[model samples]
Target: MTQFNEDWKSDRIGSALRGENPLVITEMSSGFAVMGDTQFLPGYCVFLPKKTVESLEALPMPERTAYLSDASLVGEAVLRATGAKRINYSIYGNTDAFLHTHIFPRYHSEPPERISRPVWDYPAEHWKSNDDSYKEEQHGLLRDKIATALTQLMEEAYLEKDV
Candidate 1:
Protein backbone atom coordinates (compact mmCIF):
# COMPACT_ATOMS: atom_id res chain seq x y z
CA MET A 1 0.00 0.00 0.00
CA THR A 2 1.13 3.59 -0.65
CA GLN A 3 1.61 6.25 2.01
CA PHE A 4 -1.11 8.36 0.43
CA ASN A 5 -3.77 5.64 0.22
CA GLU A 6 -3.19 4.99 3.89
CA ASP A 7 -3.16 8.63 5.00
CA TRP A 8 -4.15 10.92 2.17
CA LYS A 9 -7.31 11.94 4.01
CA SER A 10 -5.05 13.64 6.53
CA ASP A 11 -4.02 16.19 3.90
CA ARG A 12 -5.86 15.73 0.64
CA ILE A 13 -4.70 18.92 -1.04
CA GLY A 14 -1.12 18.46 0.07
CA SER A 15 -0.94 14.89 -1.14
CA ALA A 16 -2.60 15.86 -4.41
CA LEU A 17 -0.01 18.55 -4.94
CA ARG A 18 2.71 15.97 -4.42
CA GLY A 19 1.08 13.66 -6.96
CA GLU A 20 0.59 11.06 -4.27
CA ASN A 21 -3.19 11.02 -4.16
CA PRO A 22 -4.48 8.14 -6.22
CA LEU A 23 -7.90 9.76 -6.41
CA VAL A 24 -6.57 12.70 -8.37
CA ILE A 25 -7.98 12.78 -11.89
CA THR A 26 -6.24 15.92 -13.08
CA GLU A 27 -4.60 19.12 -11.94
CA MET A 28 -6.50 22.25 -12.92
CA SER A 29 -4.99 25.71 -13.29
CA SER A 30 -6.44 26.71 -9.94
CA GLY A 31 -6.89 23.33 -8.30
CA PHE A 32 -6.93 19.56 -8.54
CA ALA A 33 -9.83 17.40 -9.68
CA VAL A 34 -10.22 14.31 -7.51
CA MET A 35 -12.67 11.44 -7.72
CA GLY A 36 -14.97 11.22 -4.73
CA ASP A 37 -14.51 8.35 -2.29
CA THR A 38 -17.96 6.92 -2.82
CA GLN A 39 -19.96 6.21 -5.93
CA PHE A 40 -23.38 6.94 -4.45
CA LEU A 41 -23.53 9.31 -7.35
CA PRO A 42 -21.26 8.08 -10.09
CA GLY A 43 -18.87 10.65 -11.44
CA TYR A 44 -18.96 12.53 -8.16
CA CYS A 45 -15.77 14.62 -7.82
CA VAL A 46 -14.13 17.39 -5.81
CA PHE A 47 -12.12 20.48 -6.69
CA LEU A 48 -9.35 21.43 -4.29
CA PRO A 49 -7.42 24.66 -4.37
CA LYS A 50 -3.63 24.74 -4.67
CA LYS A 51 -3.25 25.75 -1.04
CA THR A 52 -5.10 25.40 2.22
CA VAL A 53 -7.64 28.00 3.30
CA GLU A 54 -10.63 27.79 5.59
CA SER A 55 -13.21 29.12 3.14
CA LEU A 56 -13.63 30.56 -0.33
CA GLU A 57 -14.13 34.04 1.10
CA ALA A 58 -10.58 33.88 2.41
CA LEU A 59 -9.09 33.92 -1.07
CA PRO A 60 -8.30 37.15 -2.90
CA MET A 61 -10.71 38.09 -5.69
CA PRO A 62 -8.59 36.70 -8.52
CA GLU A 63 -7.86 33.45 -6.70
CA ARG A 64 -11.50 33.21 -5.68
CA THR A 65 -12.64 33.60 -9.28
CA ALA A 66 -10.19 30.97 -10.44
CA TYR A 67 -11.34 28.53 -7.77
CA LEU A 68 -15.00 29.08 -8.61
CA SER A 69 -14.38 28.91 -12.32
CA ASP A 70 -12.46 25.68 -11.81
CA ALA A 71 -15.37 24.28 -9.83
CA SER A 72 -17.82 24.90 -12.68
CA LEU A 73 -15.36 23.54 -15.16
CA VAL A 74 -15.21 20.35 -13.11
CA GLY A 75 -19.01 20.28 -13.00
CA GLU A 76 -19.25 20.53 -16.77
CA ALA A 77 -16.69 17.76 -17.17
CA VAL A 78 -18.60 15.55 -14.76
CA LEU A 79 -21.77 16.21 -16.70
CA ARG A 80 -20.23 15.42 -20.07
CA ALA A 81 -18.46 12.35 -18.75
CA THR A 82 -21.35 10.90 -16.79
CA GLY A 83 -24.24 12.02 -18.99
CA ALA A 84 -26.11 13.05 -15.85
CA LYS A 85 -29.28 15.10 -16.24
CA ARG A 86 -27.59 17.93 -14.39
CA ILE A 87 -24.75 18.73 -12.02
CA ASN A 88 -24.93 19.99 -8.45
CA TYR A 89 -22.09 22.12 -7.08
CA SER A 90 -21.49 22.57 -3.38
CA ILE A 91 -18.97 24.20 -1.05
CA TYR A 92 -19.44 23.55 2.64
CA GLY A 93 -16.32 23.84 4.77
CA ASN A 94 -17.86 22.04 7.72
CA THR A 95 -15.86 18.84 7.44
CA ASP A 96 -12.56 19.15 5.58
CA ALA A 97 -12.56 22.96 5.77
CA PHE A 98 -10.00 23.31 3.00
CA LEU A 99 -11.99 25.49 0.64
CA HIS A 100 -13.00 22.82 -1.81
CA THR A 101 -16.06 22.24 -3.97
CA HIS A 102 -18.06 19.08 -4.40
CA ILE A 103 -19.27 18.31 -7.88
CA PHE A 104 -22.16 15.84 -7.97
CA PRO A 105 -23.84 14.52 -11.07
CA ARG A 106 -27.59 14.21 -10.74
CA TYR A 107 -29.15 11.62 -12.96
CA HIS A 108 -32.71 11.29 -14.24
CA SER A 109 -32.77 7.65 -13.20
CA GLU A 110 -32.44 8.47 -9.51
CA PRO A 111 -35.38 7.69 -7.24
CA PRO A 112 -38.03 10.40 -7.44
CA GLU A 113 -37.44 11.35 -3.82
CA ARG A 114 -33.69 11.60 -4.20
CA ILE A 115 -33.63 13.29 -7.58
CA SER A 116 -34.36 16.71 -6.11
CA ARG A 117 -32.86 16.40 -2.66
CA PRO A 118 -29.36 17.51 -1.72
CA VAL A 119 -26.69 14.85 -1.92
CA TRP A 120 -26.28 15.14 1.83
CA ASP A 121 -29.93 14.23 2.30
CA TYR A 122 -29.04 10.72 1.29
CA PRO A 123 -28.51 8.33 4.17
CA ALA A 124 -25.12 8.48 5.85
CA GLU A 125 -24.51 4.83 5.09
CA HIS A 126 -24.38 5.80 1.46
CA TRP A 127 -21.21 7.74 2.08
CA LYS A 128 -19.45 4.91 3.89
CA SER A 129 -20.81 1.86 2.19
CA ASN A 130 -18.16 -0.34 0.64
CA ASP A 131 -20.60 -1.17 -2.12
CA ASP A 132 -20.41 2.44 -3.23
CA SER A 133 -16.71 2.97 -2.70
CA TYR A 134 -14.56 3.88 -5.68
CA LYS A 135 -12.83 0.84 -7.18
CA GLU A 136 -10.33 1.14 -9.95
CA GLU A 137 -11.77 -1.91 -11.68
CA GLN A 138 -15.17 -0.30 -11.76
CA HIS A 139 -14.64 3.46 -11.86
CA GLY A 140 -11.26 3.98 -13.46
CA LEU A 141 -12.85 4.41 -16.88
CA LEU A 142 -15.23 7.07 -15.61
CA ARG A 143 -12.38 8.87 -13.90
CA ASP A 144 -10.37 8.82 -17.10
CA LYS A 145 -13.31 10.20 -19.03
CA ILE A 146 -13.78 13.07 -16.62
CA ALA A 147 -10.06 13.84 -16.67
CA THR A 148 -10.00 13.86 -20.46
CA ALA A 149 -12.97 16.18 -20.64
CA LEU A 150 -11.52 18.58 -18.08
CA THR A 151 -8.13 18.67 -19.78
CA GLN A 152 -9.78 19.52 -23.09
CA LEU A 153 -11.91 22.23 -21.54
CA MET A 154 -8.87 23.80 -19.93
CA GLU A 155 -6.94 23.70 -23.18
CA GLU A 156 -9.79 25.44 -24.95
CA ALA A 157 -9.95 28.08 -22.27
CA TYR A 158 -6.23 28.70 -22.58
CA LEU A 159 -6.48 28.97 -26.36
CA GLU A 160 -9.29 31.50 -26.02
CA LYS A 161 -7.11 33.57 -23.70
CA ASP A 162 -4.39 33.65 -26.34
CA VAL A 163 -6.77 34.69 -29.12
Candidate 2:
Protein backbone atom coordinates (compact mmCIF):
# COMPACT_ATOMS: atom_id res chain seq x y z
CA MET A 1 0.00 0.00 0.00
CA THR A 2 1.30 3.45 -0.85
CA GLN A 3 1.37 5.85 2.06
CA PHE A 4 0.12 9.39 1.64
CA ASN A 5 2.70 12.05 2.43
CA GLU A 6 2.10 15.58 3.70
CA ASP A 7 4.23 17.13 0.98
CA TRP A 8 1.92 18.61 -1.65
CA LYS A 9 4.48 17.81 -4.33
CA SER A 10 3.71 14.14 -3.71
CA ASP A 11 0.43 12.67 -4.99
CA ARG A 12 -0.17 11.02 -1.59
CA ILE A 13 -0.63 14.49 -0.10
CA GLY A 14 -4.35 14.21 -0.91
CA SER A 15 -4.67 11.37 1.57
CA ALA A 16 -3.19 13.44 4.36
CA LEU A 17 -5.48 16.29 3.32
CA ARG A 18 -8.32 13.81 3.76
CA GLY A 19 -7.37 13.60 7.47
CA GLU A 20 -5.34 10.38 7.09
CA ASN A 21 -8.26 8.37 5.78
CA PRO A 22 -7.35 6.10 2.88
CA LEU A 23 -10.50 3.98 2.94
CA VAL A 24 -13.42 6.32 2.08
CA ILE A 25 -11.32 9.00 0.37
CA THR A 26 -7.90 8.65 -1.26
CA GLU A 27 -5.60 9.39 -4.15
CA MET A 28 -6.68 7.75 -7.42
CA SER A 29 -4.52 5.01 -8.97
CA SER A 30 -2.43 7.70 -10.60
CA GLY A 31 -2.48 9.08 -7.03
CA PHE A 32 -4.37 12.42 -7.08
CA ALA A 33 -7.91 12.06 -5.70
CA VAL A 34 -8.63 13.70 -2.30
CA MET A 35 -11.09 15.44 0.00
CA GLY A 36 -10.38 19.07 0.77
CA ASP A 37 -10.12 20.38 4.38
CA THR A 38 -12.97 22.85 4.27
CA GLN A 39 -16.47 21.71 5.25
CA PHE A 40 -17.77 25.09 4.10
CA LEU A 41 -18.24 23.61 0.65
CA PRO A 42 -18.87 20.24 2.27
CA GLY A 43 -18.15 17.10 0.16
CA TYR A 44 -15.54 18.97 -1.90
CA CYS A 45 -13.05 16.49 -3.37
CA VAL A 46 -10.04 16.18 -5.73
CA PHE A 47 -8.13 13.52 -7.68
CA LEU A 48 -4.37 13.99 -8.14
CA PRO A 49 -1.71 11.96 -9.91
CA LYS A 50 1.38 10.47 -8.25
CA LYS A 51 3.83 11.28 -10.98
CA THR A 52 4.03 14.62 -12.84
CA VAL A 53 2.11 13.33 -15.83
CA GLU A 54 0.14 16.29 -17.25
CA SER A 55 -1.98 14.73 -19.97
CA LEU A 56 -4.55 12.01 -19.34
CA GLU A 57 -3.05 10.02 -22.21
CA ALA A 58 0.23 9.90 -20.29
CA LEU A 59 -1.34 7.16 -18.15
CA PRO A 60 -1.44 3.59 -19.37
CA MET A 61 -4.77 2.05 -20.38
CA PRO A 62 -5.29 0.08 -17.15
CA GLU A 63 -4.24 3.02 -15.02
CA ARG A 64 -6.59 5.29 -16.89
CA THR A 65 -9.47 2.87 -16.37
CA ALA A 66 -8.72 2.56 -12.66
CA TYR A 67 -8.36 6.33 -12.36
CA LEU A 68 -11.82 6.89 -13.76
CA SER A 69 -13.24 4.19 -11.51
CA ASP A 70 -11.61 5.76 -8.47
CA ALA A 71 -12.88 9.21 -9.40
CA SER A 72 -16.41 7.89 -9.79
CA LEU A 73 -16.21 6.08 -6.46
CA VAL A 74 -15.12 9.23 -4.65
CA GLY A 75 -17.86 11.25 -6.29
CA GLU A 76 -20.46 8.66 -5.33
CA ALA A 77 -19.20 8.61 -1.77
CA VAL A 78 -19.52 12.37 -1.52
CA LEU A 79 -23.03 12.28 -2.97
CA ARG A 80 -24.10 9.58 -0.52
CA ALA A 81 -22.39 11.18 2.43
CA THR A 82 -23.69 14.70 1.82
CA GLY A 83 -26.97 13.98 0.00
CA ALA A 84 -25.79 16.63 -2.44
CA LYS A 85 -28.08 17.79 -5.19
CA ARG A 86 -25.38 17.62 -7.84
CA ILE A 87 -21.66 16.99 -8.13
CA ASN A 88 -19.38 19.22 -10.19
CA TYR A 89 -15.99 17.94 -11.33
CA SER A 90 -13.30 20.32 -12.59
CA ILE A 91 -9.67 19.95 -13.66
CA TYR A 92 -7.99 23.33 -14.03
CA GLY A 93 -4.36 22.98 -12.97
CA ASN A 94 -3.66 26.68 -13.54
CA THR A 95 -3.48 27.76 -9.88
CA ASP A 96 -1.63 24.65 -8.78
CA ALA A 97 1.08 22.91 -10.77
CA PHE A 98 -0.17 19.44 -9.91
CA LEU A 99 -2.92 18.25 -12.25
CA HIS A 100 -5.93 17.32 -10.12
CA THR A 101 -9.70 17.05 -10.36
CA HIS A 102 -11.91 19.22 -8.14
CA ILE A 103 -15.24 17.62 -7.16
CA PHE A 104 -17.70 20.16 -5.76
CA PRO A 105 -21.01 19.07 -4.27
CA ARG A 106 -23.72 21.59 -5.00
CA TYR A 107 -26.43 21.86 -2.36
CA HIS A 108 -29.80 23.56 -2.10
CA SER A 109 -28.74 26.41 0.17
CA GLU A 110 -25.10 25.91 0.87
CA PRO A 111 -21.93 28.07 1.08
CA PRO A 112 -23.54 29.88 4.01
CA GLU A 113 -23.54 33.66 3.43
CA ARG A 114 -21.23 33.94 0.43
CA ILE A 115 -23.45 31.91 -1.89
CA SER A 116 -22.81 34.21 -4.82
CA ARG A 117 -19.01 33.93 -4.74
CA PRO A 118 -16.72 31.18 -5.88
CA VAL A 119 -15.66 28.85 -3.08
CA TRP A 120 -12.03 29.90 -3.38
CA ASP A 121 -12.96 33.59 -3.49
CA TYR A 122 -14.84 33.41 -0.18
CA PRO A 123 -12.98 34.65 2.89
CA ALA A 124 -10.86 32.03 4.58
CA GLU A 125 -12.62 32.78 7.86
CA HIS A 126 -15.90 31.53 6.38
CA TRP A 127 -14.53 28.01 6.59
CA LYS A 128 -13.94 25.91 9.65
CA SER A 129 -10.44 25.78 11.11
CA ASN A 130 -8.41 22.55 11.32
CA ASP A 131 -6.43 23.95 14.26
CA ASP A 132 -8.35 22.22 17.04
CA SER A 133 -7.80 18.53 17.73
CA TYR A 134 -11.54 18.06 18.14
CA LYS A 135 -12.14 19.57 14.72
CA GLU A 136 -9.47 17.32 13.24
CA GLU A 137 -11.05 14.31 14.92
CA GLN A 138 -14.42 15.21 13.47
CA HIS A 139 -12.92 15.49 10.02
CA GLY A 140 -11.22 12.15 10.53
CA LEU A 141 -14.57 10.59 11.41
CA LEU A 142 -16.25 11.93 8.29
CA ARG A 143 -13.31 10.86 6.18
CA ASP A 144 -13.53 7.36 7.63
CA LYS A 145 -17.14 7.08 6.58
CA ILE A 146 -16.28 8.07 3.05
CA ALA A 147 -13.33 5.67 3.06
CA THR A 148 -15.60 2.84 4.11
CA ALA A 149 -17.92 3.56 1.24
CA LEU A 150 -15.04 3.72 -1.21
CA THR A 151 -13.72 0.40 0.02
CA GLN A 152 -17.09 -1.22 -0.56
CA LEU A 153 -17.12 0.25 -4.02
CA MET A 154 -13.70 -1.19 -4.80
CA GLU A 155 -14.81 -4.61 -3.58
CA GLU A 156 -17.90 -4.54 -5.74
CA ALA A 157 -15.99 -3.37 -8.76
CA TYR A 158 -13.34 -6.04 -8.36
CA LEU A 159 -15.93 -8.71 -7.84
CA GLU A 160 -17.06 -7.98 -11.37
CA LYS A 161 -13.48 -7.70 -12.60
CA ASP A 162 -14.12 -4.02 -13.19
CA VAL A 163 -11.00 -2.96 -11.31
Candidate 3:
Protein backbone atom coordinates (compact mmCIF):
# COMPACT_ATOMS: atom_id res chain seq x y z
CA MET A 1 0.00 0.00 0.00
CA THR A 2 1.12 3.54 -0.64
CA GLN A 3 1.97 5.58 2.41
CA PHE A 4 1.13 9.26 2.65
CA ASN A 5 3.43 11.71 4.32
CA GLU A 6 2.66 15.03 5.99
CA ASP A 7 2.68 16.60 2.55
CA TRP A 8 -0.13 14.34 1.48
CA LYS A 9 -1.95 15.34 4.61
CA SER A 10 -1.46 19.00 3.77
CA ASP A 11 -3.19 18.58 0.44
CA ARG A 12 -6.93 18.84 0.28
CA ILE A 13 -8.87 15.64 1.03
CA GLY A 14 -12.53 14.72 0.70
CA SER A 15 -13.32 17.19 -2.03
CA ALA A 16 -15.84 14.58 -3.04
CA LEU A 17 -17.79 15.34 0.12
CA ARG A 18 -19.04 18.57 -1.42
CA GLY A 19 -21.02 17.91 -4.57
CA GLU A 20 -24.35 17.49 -6.38
CA ASN A 21 -24.43 13.74 -6.52
CA PRO A 22 -27.74 11.91 -6.56
CA LEU A 23 -26.22 10.61 -3.31
CA VAL A 24 -23.75 11.97 -0.75
CA ILE A 25 -24.90 15.03 1.18
CA THR A 26 -22.46 16.53 3.60
CA GLU A 27 -18.97 16.86 5.00
CA MET A 28 -18.73 16.48 8.74
CA SER A 29 -15.77 17.41 10.89
CA SER A 30 -15.09 13.76 11.54
CA GLY A 31 -15.62 13.10 7.82
CA PHE A 32 -17.54 13.74 4.66
CA ALA A 33 -19.96 11.45 2.80
CA VAL A 34 -20.49 11.33 -0.95
CA MET A 35 -21.64 8.95 -3.64
CA GLY A 36 -19.22 6.07 -4.03
CA ASP A 37 -16.43 6.49 -6.54
CA THR A 38 -17.16 3.12 -8.09
CA GLN A 39 -20.52 2.96 -9.82
CA PHE A 40 -20.73 -0.83 -9.35
CA LEU A 41 -23.00 0.14 -6.50
CA PRO A 42 -24.65 3.53 -6.63
CA GLY A 43 -24.90 5.89 -3.65
CA TYR A 44 -21.79 4.39 -2.07
CA CYS A 45 -20.05 7.23 -0.26
CA VAL A 46 -17.03 7.36 2.02
CA PHE A 47 -17.21 9.54 5.15
CA LEU A 48 -13.71 10.71 5.89
CA PRO A 49 -13.07 13.23 8.62
CA LYS A 50 -11.11 16.45 8.40
CA LYS A 51 -8.62 15.49 11.05
CA THR A 52 -6.73 12.32 11.89
CA VAL A 53 -8.14 11.24 15.25
CA GLU A 54 -8.04 7.45 15.16
CA SER A 55 -10.70 6.04 17.53
CA LEU A 56 -14.05 7.77 17.89
CA GLU A 57 -13.82 7.42 21.67
CA ALA A 58 -10.64 9.46 21.60
CA LEU A 59 -12.51 12.53 20.44
CA PRO A 60 -13.54 15.14 23.00
CA MET A 61 -17.12 14.89 24.17
CA PRO A 62 -18.44 17.82 22.18
CA GLU A 63 -16.63 16.63 19.06
CA ARG A 64 -17.85 13.08 19.53
CA THR A 65 -21.42 14.29 19.78
CA ALA A 66 -21.00 16.55 16.79
CA TYR A 67 -19.36 13.80 14.77
CA LEU A 68 -22.26 11.44 15.33
CA SER A 69 -24.64 14.21 14.40
CA ASP A 70 -22.75 14.81 11.20
CA ALA A 71 -22.66 11.12 10.43
CA SER A 72 -26.40 10.94 10.86
CA LEU A 73 -26.84 13.98 8.67
CA VAL A 74 -24.87 12.27 5.97
CA GLY A 75 -26.99 9.18 6.41
CA GLU A 76 -30.19 11.15 6.01
CA ALA A 77 -28.77 12.90 2.97
CA VAL A 78 -27.86 9.58 1.40
CA LEU A 79 -31.32 8.23 1.99
CA ARG A 80 -32.95 11.41 0.69
CA ALA A 81 -30.74 11.39 -2.38
CA THR A 82 -30.89 7.70 -3.23
CA GLY A 83 -34.14 6.48 -1.73
CA ALA A 84 -32.25 3.40 -0.58
CA LYS A 85 -34.11 0.87 1.52
CA ARG A 86 -31.38 1.02 4.17
CA ILE A 87 -28.04 2.65 4.86
CA ASN A 88 -25.06 0.76 6.21
CA TYR A 89 -22.58 2.65 8.33
CA SER A 90 -19.09 1.37 9.22
CA ILE A 91 -15.90 2.73 10.62
CA TYR A 92 -12.65 1.02 9.65
CA GLY A 93 -9.58 2.89 10.81
CA ASN A 94 -7.31 0.02 9.75
CA THR A 95 -6.46 1.47 6.33
CA ASP A 96 -5.29 4.71 7.91
CA ALA A 97 -5.31 5.77 11.53
CA PHE A 98 -6.88 8.99 10.28
CA LEU A 99 -10.41 8.28 11.42
CA HIS A 100 -12.93 7.73 8.63
CA THR A 101 -16.30 6.12 8.05
CA HIS A 102 -18.20 4.48 5.24
CA ILE A 103 -21.83 5.31 4.48
CA PHE A 104 -23.11 2.64 2.11
CA PRO A 105 -26.61 2.51 0.70
CA ARG A 106 -27.63 -1.14 0.77
CA TYR A 107 -30.02 -2.64 -1.69
CA HIS A 108 -31.34 -6.16 -1.01
CA SER A 109 -28.76 -7.84 -3.27
CA GLU A 110 -25.55 -5.95 -2.74
CA PRO A 111 -22.65 -8.37 -2.07
CA PRO A 112 -21.17 -8.31 1.37
CA GLU A 113 -17.64 -7.03 1.75
CA ARG A 114 -17.33 -10.00 4.04
CA ILE A 115 -18.93 -13.39 3.56
CA SER A 116 -20.51 -15.92 5.94
CA ARG A 117 -17.27 -16.02 7.91
CA PRO A 118 -16.77 -13.10 10.26
CA VAL A 119 -13.27 -12.71 8.93
CA TRP A 120 -13.38 -10.95 5.60
CA ASP A 121 -10.39 -10.65 3.31
CA TYR A 122 -10.16 -9.29 -0.19
CA PRO A 123 -7.50 -8.28 -2.69
CA ALA A 124 -6.23 -4.73 -2.23
CA GLU A 125 -4.89 -2.23 -4.67
CA HIS A 126 -2.86 0.75 -3.56
CA TRP A 127 -3.02 3.97 -5.56
CA LYS A 128 0.07 3.56 -7.72
CA SER A 129 0.09 7.08 -9.13
CA ASN A 130 -0.88 10.66 -8.27
CA ASP A 131 -2.56 11.43 -11.58
CA ASP A 132 -6.00 11.56 -10.01
CA SER A 133 -7.16 14.77 -11.68
CA TYR A 134 -10.41 13.12 -12.53
CA LYS A 135 -10.92 12.33 -8.88
CA GLU A 136 -10.01 15.91 -8.03
CA GLU A 137 -12.52 17.31 -10.47
CA GLN A 138 -15.20 14.95 -9.27
CA HIS A 139 -14.45 15.91 -5.70
CA GLY A 140 -14.75 19.62 -6.49
CA LEU A 141 -18.11 19.23 -8.18
CA LEU A 142 -19.46 17.01 -5.45
CA ARG A 143 -18.25 19.31 -2.75
CA ASP A 144 -20.36 22.13 -4.17
CA LYS A 145 -23.45 19.94 -4.29
CA ILE A 146 -23.04 18.58 -0.80
CA ALA A 147 -22.43 21.99 0.63
CA THR A 148 -25.63 23.26 -0.93
CA ALA A 149 -27.61 20.28 0.28
CA LEU A 150 -26.15 20.55 3.75
CA THR A 151 -27.03 24.22 3.94
CA GLN A 152 -30.63 23.44 3.10
CA LEU A 153 -30.73 20.57 5.59
CA MET A 154 -29.21 22.70 8.29
CA GLU A 155 -31.78 25.42 7.73
CA GLU A 156 -34.58 22.90 7.95
CA ALA A 157 -33.11 21.24 11.00
CA TYR A 158 -32.51 24.50 12.76
CA LEU A 159 -35.99 25.75 12.02
CA GLU A 160 -37.76 22.53 12.88
CA LYS A 161 -35.70 21.58 15.92
CA ASP A 162 -33.57 23.36 18.52
CA VAL A 163 -30.37 22.15 16.83
Candidate with the greatest TM-score versus the true structure: 1
The local lDDT score (0 to 100) that residue 82 gets in candidate 3 is 60
Report the C-alpha lDDT of model 2 over 102-143, residue by residue, as the tens digit: 777778786556454456665666455654222344566666
Q: Give a tens-digit lDDT track for model 3, residues 24-143.
A: 345545555555444333455666556557778878988887777777777666666566667777877785665666676556554465332221232222123233221434454544
- The predicted structure with the larger lDDT, 1 or 3, is 1
**Residues 30-139, model 1: lDDT tens digits:** 89999999998999999999999999999999999988988898999999999999999999999786788999999999999999899999999999999999888899
Candidates in order have lDDT scores of: 0.90, 0.63, 0.54
lDDT value for candidate 2?
0.63
lDDT of 1: 0.90
- In candidate 3 the C-alpha lDDT for residue 48 amounts to 56
Using alpha carbons, what is the TM-score of model 1? Answer: 0.96
Between candidates 1 and 2, which one is better according to TM-score? 1
Return the candidate ranking by lDDT, descending: 1, 2, 3
Provide the lDDT at 139 for model 2: 69
Model 3 bad stretches (over 4 Å): 1-31, 109-150, 160-163
Best by lDDT: 1
Poorly placed runs, candidate 1 (over 4 Å) = 1-4
